[model samples]
Target chain A: MTTPALEAKGISKRWPRTGAVLADCSLRVERRTVHALIGASGSGKSTLLRCLGLLEPPDAGSILVDGALAVDQGVVAADRSVRRSVGMVFQEPSLFAHLSALANVSLAPHRVLGLDPESARNRACSALDRVHALHLADRRPDELSGGERQRVAIARALAMEPSVLLCDEPTSALDPLLTREVMAVLRELALDAGTTMVVVTHDLDFVAAAADSVDFLHAGRIRISGTADLLGTRGLDDELDRFLQRS
Target chain B: MPRVLAPLLVLLATMAAAADDGMARLRASGIMRWGCDISGGAPFAFPDPSDPDRVIGFEVEIAEELAHRLGVRAERFSADWLALIDALEADRCDLLINGFEVTADRERVVAFSTPYFRYAQQLVVRAEDRDRFTSLADLAGRPIAVLNGSASIESLRSAGVPPSLIVEYDDSLAPFTETILGRVDACLQESFIAQFFAGHDPRLALVDAAFDPGIYAVVVRQGDDDLLASVNAALASMRADGTLGRILQRWGLWSDAQRELGIDRGPIIATIPEAIGTPPEDGLPWSLVLWSLARAAAMTALLTIVSMPIATFVGLLLAIAILHGPKPLSRFCHGYVLLTRGTPLLVQIFLLYYSLPALGAWLGIPELLTWNKVVVGIVCLAANYAAYEAEIHRAALQAIPQSQWDAARALGFTRAQTLRFIIVPQSWRLSLPAIINDLNSLIKDSSLVSMIGVQELLAVALGIGKASFAVPSMLVAAAAFYLVLSLLADWFGQSLERRARTVGTLPEPIHR
Candidate 1:
């Protein structure tokens, strides 16, 4: 009965330099859901996720956060307010290399929310603890390992307390053990806090094992979508199935 | 026709208004501003040894007396000795009481008051060579030093000395110093200058005869007859009261030439004033020399420090504007950089400090920005270095990775925030070494400001060298000071760079 936690309708984008295009793609994630948008490289899934996070505005699209219009067609609904409601974790850790892990995680709340430093730092600490990265909080990104950096990055997003989180390949650079650990942390955040997450990845195995819902993106559109169980039985559209199998 | 005639009449009225009000202005203000160049040193107008800030010379004493007789407070305006006429014409000062030798070329530009001192050019040679070069013809093949634009040039030519064999110097004392250093065989300079600058040294001796006697006088702007009359009357009274002779006597400058000119016809001074600093020793006094140069070194350091921040700030804004501003504004910044960097710094200083005021006067604009020598030096130095700094910043900014901007913006930072937090810090770190190198160059380039009349370290050292004829040693001391100042700047810059590398954190020093 509740509206999906995040929704995109009719998203499209184009690169003027090379004439690449993403046409008419849409996706929805339910409250507390672990949704994976799966596609091969160059399928435009990462671009769509970035557009949903408002990092790059889509040429055309409407994005909704908790059924409220956060972006209408080409215009962003609000700048900091809309961005505050939706958080994103990049494919790489993308931590501010100049900052300590704690400062990196606390920067947005301190800068955007005008939270006093102490409270912002405390909130950052709690977010790090959520991802079990408390030990790495004082270290710089250069000092942290691949998995620790990702975890700190996740903490950076979680500290913002957004309604929806979009992550692009959050486990792409990790080993299998660290991948499982990061997945487990994400699953726990979804289950405990009822936070919705939409992850873009080519990891079909990750989708099959961890996603509550799945969308198969090909070319520029979501070619197939269903609950994981249904998608597991039905398979993706034929071409994408083969593509996913190869990836 | 009437419209044209009306404008012509207005123009004539304005010219009439501009006519000489010199004496009236002096009376109204109650201050007789004397234009002078204290860097001329010693017998003319030089820094007092006991208090270097208080200038003292024979001319300084004469100006005080003249101002007293005229019932006004005396004020001294320091100008480049070479540019004193320009200062007088600019109405920046009323009289030039510096050792202005009367010459027809100068009289064509400004009126000369009655002769205050008269002297013939004296030939000076090293003590050992005093017997070798007795007459001008004896110096036929050897190098002889003469002041540039002095009456001695005509005397040397008339003496049958080949023009190519004579070395001319623009500075007042360079000829004498060059002679003492044996860079020239002999020097022909005014007799009074010989007494003060070269006569003190044991190695130099003045030949008994003097040549081409000339008078020194107060210079007033042409057409300022009212001011000229008052200055002449003051000179007559000083001559009557023996004040003029006493001042010349104190500086050890009273000579036969003054009596021959019929001005100082008073009794000859038998004893030199005890206050005259013991005649500069045979060579430079290194201890006192270093002490004097240290003050100049401090001034150079202060100039560098004050102007560099301005250069850095201006360079930063210029770089940002060139890189990020709209098309027209960016183009303007590019043009500005090209113009400032393309021109010689000396030319820029001259244009800004000298030519610009002339241009302002021609344009009839009031309150045009004319600054003192030091300020003009700083402004020109900052502006010149700013162009280089801007280019450094631009290259550094461009070198910043795009990923940094993406990361900052992805965190919801505005464009300005992203630039301030992510881009500028990295760019500045990348550019610090280059900027510091430029700063070292700027410190050396600061000496060029002296040409515009800033009495910075090198200028001060040159003055001492001129006074003592110890150019080589004084120049060596100046070189050491500049070397140390540059080294200090380098060390400071490296320390800053180390701190910047740690991203604003002060790291603990490493110990073995």
Candidate 2:
């Protein structure tokens, strides 16, 4: 009867230009689990992940983080709890270009966590080591290779010591080999380090290998919700069977 | 007026009256501040070459004696010669007293004291041609340089010199300088100037043909009868006791024409002090000339340094408000940039330095807008450049990609934190070249403050060029100064860029 690690119910978002992009979407992710929100482009999967991360507010829904109310019915408090508990990795390869990779990783810990310079740097080094990006600490983002940048980005999220990591297509900009490399790092973080993550992507092989549970978001709602074994059992739904055929 | 504000209005009225009555202000301050254009070279208010701070000229002595008679020491206020009269009308000085002639037209705006010295137009030509062009009539067809606003042009025209053949120079020794350079055939100017500015030169000689007699006098604001009467009495006493003769005789300006003012004078003799550096004939020593230029350059540099930081800060605030402030404030800042950019910096200098005080008076805020010249110079410069700097900064701030802002916010950063750490530093790199370009031109424009009587590099060149008659040399030296400072600014900008370069890339060395 332990509460789910993160939960959302009846989440809806309306954009001024494109109305009702997400409508009454719901999901539940258990602790230390790799949950993937998968859909084609414009399916509102990213919008739902953004809502879970508090990057955006849903027009109507409640989000609970580890059985605690982080947002209710679009009424968000001045809540540092959500910010402190969740770390976000965006689809864009975003880094502070003026700083070195190490400095970029260390900045939030020192500023947000109020760590001293030496302690923040140590935390960043250990996080980078965990993702096997320790050697790229001195390079600026422009100097790092594509796969190396994604590894360092994962390390940046890890440096925050978050209970949940919300990633929006972190491998969308990478090639197949680089995408395999980044998904391997994510799988290792989930299995070995017990870091919970909700990844939003449409990579089928990645879902087959890394996801413990999957939500098939179609037309802004969770149309298929089950364990990753559902991808192997595709005859149940015609749309799901066709999605597997294309991949 | 309401009873509560009655005391405040009376206080303001008293202040307005005190500011207006130049004589009372002089007496109250115990310093009779007199206005003169220092470029009125030798025996008129030119700076002493040995020590330019110790202004030594016949007019300087006359002003001192007049101030002593009025029970106050004289303090000299120098402005551009063309602006000295406006300076007087603005109450920047108690009276104007730099060789003002007693002309009927001048009498309409300002009252004149009795003539202090007498002069007539004289012809000056190359020493080798002095015999060939001894009179104005002999110079009819050749190029003749005459003081632009003086009686010389009328006299030259009346004596049958062709109008096309006449070259007009504004009231400085530039006419005679053209004769020295062999650019003109002859110069027709007053005798006193001809003697000091060109007669001292071994290459030039003054013809004995003196015509179009005029008399120099002190000028006071028209309704300043008390100060006018005091100045006239000082002149009369100086003449009666021979102090005026001694002063004029020292500069070789004593003339037989003084008998008309009731003074029997002694023989005229030239006696430029030996300690006052060398004469104009030797030209100013290069070391002394450069030293004056160095001081002037320092003023220009100091003005740039002091005002630029303020300008950049003001520009940054303006840029931020335009980008991030509420809609009305953003629009207002954008409009401010447009308004400031549309106007000339020269007009801004005059409006702030001159018209602001006048406006303040009309608004019944006595002395509210009055600032010292240097302060006014800084204010005007800082404000004018702020408009351009704001535009540069706005572009720079916008150039930092939104991805970086999203990254910082996702890392739990507040808006201010993101701007301080992530946005501004990167934007500064994008905007560096444009900001430095603004800075380079601002160094050059610092010289424009001289229009407000700021004695920076170019003003020094004007003063020394006129006094030494080495016009070309002094001017070239001043130009070299501005070029050096602009190069230094370029260097500073590049060094900062190199320090902040992206980690692994090497920036190319600047090619000359």
Candidate 3:
């Protein structure tokens, strides 16, 4: 099989105050595919996503991106290259309040990637256009609506053209109507641009509709993992079934 | 025609003043600036107990009588006694009339008026230690205090006392206090000062024999022959008419010095006349004061501008070091902030300008470290404020959410890059108002540097007050300059903050 775009093996994290938020969780995402991690509150879905995104250093794990070791035995390797390849969209739409959406998108390309300002700006414009957020490019974070700000944030990450994109509950703050709009754009990017994506969510319906693959996490471990089509046909295990029924 | 006439008239008046004698200018101005020291307290120039603002003393009366004779108002200009002669030479005052004793050494730099009073130096010791220090010779090996820059210091050295044994104080009271407190074995003073201080408290008494009889004279600048001659004529007339003796008698200061000079026998004045009155009606010439203030403001601007960038840069480094540097460096930065912010700016300036030179001397590199007062002021102000600025920068940096750092790091930016491009710019925006406030305060605090003799705006105005005895006007003018500069700084800071928030920012203006 072609090499997976991103892989995390036996990820475990223990917080100083709260022990064992994530434990021995492993995930594999194929190129151009949309994968979803779904769990109840207090589960380690977000923690696993963060570890895969390299936002948090796992207590124990090896992460590989594009068949190259990004983290080996819980020690980060090729950190800068790993971070450059993996992009993150925070749940709260972490846009720099001082910068316009376009500058926010262009900043990393111009400054971090050493692209010329014109080229960076052009790339920023295209990224925004790709996310259907072109109209909001010039707006500051405060000036944009909740959904528009989230889209701009996504565009900022896309501008970097990462090999894998990780988002944590990006649509959690949005109403159902805006959630649908954002998910539609995200689906288009995954299908048309062949952009690999990992999303952490609490919504089973969202996973059922948009996710190509699904992993059910509970109490810091993955209980079941499969193609979404298979899960939908064969149904969930007892624990996941109870979780789905309750939520 | 009117404008031409006005310029021509002003030119004529300026030339006339330049051509005339110093005495003529003094008479024309109708205000004689009398320089003296008031920190020494009573019997020379001390605050009048009845009206705290007005100073009263024998010298004050003498000046008033002299000004009355010269047909002008007598205005008191007080500085330290050590600075009195310098004040006279700088034209900050017309004359130094404060118990200034004429000696061969002093006569080289200044011309003294004819003798108005003559007094011998009296050695005073604590009552308990009086017998042990019976005379100057007996106190030879002991630590004896004398007024700094006084003739007493010179006389004590000549009287076979070791130079190191003679501690000099700028204020007159410190020597006597030190003696009574047993910190010093003896203190030398003019006979009259020794009498006044020792007479009040039984704990103190005079050593038996007086020494170094010297004549008190009003000192004028060396080339001020015309004013000197006029002052002599005034003194001679006061002597002939017994005005000097009567004034002295009222202050209970009539002594054999007057009898020896043949001016002691005069009508006894029963009551001490009220020498000081309400402040003079003539307000300071605002236009002239403003002109002088504007010139001084240039130095103030130089101090502020030159120091600010240095302070900010140092503060930035310190803040970063505290936050991210190695452990030792972070601790050092923390210590720096603690020490600088914990102390007074006045003490810091004194350390930088005064103690630093002493330190340099100890280090055998005094020449390199001995900077001019202005340079020292800048260095000190910058260093002192940098501690504050570092705190400001640290606060601003901390105020930025941790997510911002995460965002920058996740974007493949190095840590320094994240700080330099992303964090610092945003922190600066939040810190601008506080920084501007500090800068404004610094401009005002620049006045404290005057203690080390940097004649910045306020110092220059004060110098003018010394020369013309126009304190109110000079202060008002200096305050106005500071106010204007602060307002300008505020405006500039606001503009920068606005630019930081809006400039080159996107969300290109929208078309429907």
Candidate 4:
């Protein structure tokens, strides 16, 4: 029905000496759903997320968006139309230092979307408001708190109006209060915008609170996939259980 | 009316009495300070090679002879002809014995002794050009270079030579060399000096005809008749005893004119109808100073304006190529820097100006650019500074962070775009101050162009000094001009630096 919003079929990646970080991994995210990818530190969850986000090209298999092949048979198209449809939030705050938070959010839209300066600025302001970060729109990244910075980053990503939003441990650097605030914002954005979301994280509390579905990744392969309700009760292997306890 | 006349008469009488008192004061002092040129140019005094402090020349010998005859110990100081009048006016010296010419202009400020030698302006050309130009008429429309302040320029100008054809030089040697190098058709000098210079260099030969016959005389402070009479008496006695002849012979300056005119024998002639014009007090020629500055300004501006852009562009490219090119290419750029920086600019100029044309010919490149000595000098200066500017730009580029590059790449910009939009703009601020300093130095260094006969400011001043024998004054003026230029350059550089920092507070984007 409307074809899964994003699908990665047997995606795999290997480094020269490090061998495989993602091995024949497959993931499918339906429209208006949040999928939490959970695994240990050395697992292939982040690599899979990178592949799904189209930030990294997979060595094998294909990525499909709305039933159409976006990355086909290990070939990423020269034109980055897929990237424009997908927005990514990095683990570290890689915001451009020269621009204000508002400018940071507005840059890509004005540059790639051909939005005039006034429209781009207005869109950037609304994006900041969505994250409850409108007041800090004029502030530089250095002037913002860690939570405020993460919120601004999310606003920057949301301003692109992408179909799929990818988060790489977005809340990993935040404290408890800040983490809750950021997760709440992500949940609100997912539900209200009807956007497909994929998050690579080890935070079970976040998964329980926001994810509609979950996948357990181990040693570059997906060990299990199911509804989030089954996360703590069943279907977990001994290694995953141990990994979860350690986290 | 009677009272006014009485005061006027009294004032005149008082001035006369003061002059007498001043003379009495000088005689009582028993020390007659004589100023003379100390650079060895035959008749002019120069330091003895064995003892650098002790001077010897025809003028020095004459000065000592005059002082001995005056029954006073002569204390000598090196003096330039231009400053000799100033020195006497300031009481720094009681007499000037550095081949003083008896110009009427000089008589306004100082009195003169009977002329010791009959000096005539003569034309000099390369030995090969000797047959081409027999007299002044031969060089009427042709370019003829002459030392500034020399009687030759005046004679040549008066003889209907156009101002544009007369290339004035500050240093006589350069003007002479210019003729030898075929840059100028001819040069003019005093007959004795021309003969002396021509004898030393086989490439040059003197013409037989004289342009202007001026007399060389000893000068004393104006109203110092007693000092002038004493100097005249000593000169006459030296002529009688054949001492002047012996001095001239030692300098290889003994001539038939000295013998025929009885300049070496007694009865010294105080005046001669042959003396073309009144002697110049201070005998300082302003033309030489003006010509020197004009040439220096043109050359320095040419060197700075033309070479600076080339140097900056080439230097920046070199720095970037060295910093980012493949290993082999970078190594070559580094080697170039080492080679250029290791040598002196003067040596570089000489090689480029003198040797490169030959090399170009051997390489079979059409000599489209051959023998334009000024171009050679400019290229040499540009090449030399290019090495330095490259280093400066390299350091500035390296100071930028690699993070900038990575950020730009992450933003989907290509490598070339990143460099153009990001790296270069940032490096501009850092490289500007040093570039300005290099420019200032480049302007000053342009004076070296004179060696290639570019006829710049210092060269012009030197020519004037040589011609008028006013070396000290010309040097001072040249120094002042350079000082003013340097200050202006420095101010402009500072303003540019300030403008570069206007965007200082803006965060620089990272471009990989």
Candidate number of the best DockQ:
2
Residue-level lDDT of model 3, residues A1-247, one tens digit each, is 9999999898999999988998898889998898988878889887887788777889998999999898888988865877899999887787877788888899899887888888888999999999999988777788898889889989989999999999889888899888877777787886788888998876666677678898888899998888776345435478777777777
lDDT of each: 0.77, 0.78, 0.77, 0.69
Look at candidate 3 and tell me the lDDT of residue B383.
Answer: 96
lDDT of 2 at B110: 70
The fnat of each candidate, in order, is 0.16, 0.44, 0.44, 0.02
Q: Enumerate clash totals for all models, in the order shown.
A: 0, 0, 5, 26
Candidate 1 residue B184 C-alpha distance from true site, Å: 4.9
Listed per model, the TM-scores of chain A against the true chain A are: 0.92, 0.96, 0.95, 0.95
| Residue range B1-512, candidate 2, lDDT tens digits | 02232234334333343444666767889999888877656657876665554567888888899899888989998876656665565566778778777777667657788878888888889999978987767776789898765677777777777799889886567787688788998888888788777765788898986878988888887777777787888888888877788777777777788768765465455665631323555667778778888999999998898888888889988998999989999999999999999988876776566555554675776377777888988998999889999999999999888878777767887777777777877887887788889889889899878876788998888777766555677789999999999999999989868976854332211110
Predicted model 3 interface RMSD: 4.2
The regions of model 2 sitting more than 4 angstroms off are: A1-6, A9-20, A56-81, A219-221, B1-20, B40-43, B49-54, B89-91, B101-114, B118-171, B175-191, B194-215, B221-225, B255-283, B355-370, B502-512
lDDT of 1 by residue, B18-108 (tens): 3547899899999999988776766777765443445677888899999999999999887667666665655557889987889887776
Q: Report interface Cα RMSD per prediction.
A: 5.6, 7.0, 4.2, 5.2
User: What value does the lDDT take at residue A24 in candidate 3?
Assistant: 92
What is the Å distance of residue B15 in model 3 from its true position? 53
lDDT (10s digit) by residue, model 2, range A1-247: 7788888888999999978889898888888888998877788988898888887888999898888888898876457756667788888768778777888888888877888888888999999999899999888888987888888888888898887898899988988888888888887887788888899977777777778999987778788989888789857877677766775
Better of 3 and 4 by lDDT: 3
Better candidate number, 2 or 4, judged by lDDT? 2
Per-model TM-score versus the true fold: 0.83, 0.84, 0.67, 0.53
DockQ of each: 0.21, 0.33, 0.23, 0.05
Best first by lDDT, ranked: 2, 3, 1, 4
* Candidate scoring better on lDDT of 1 and 4: 1
User: Which stretch of 10 consecutive residues in model 2 chain A shows the poorest summed lDDT?
Assistant: A75-84
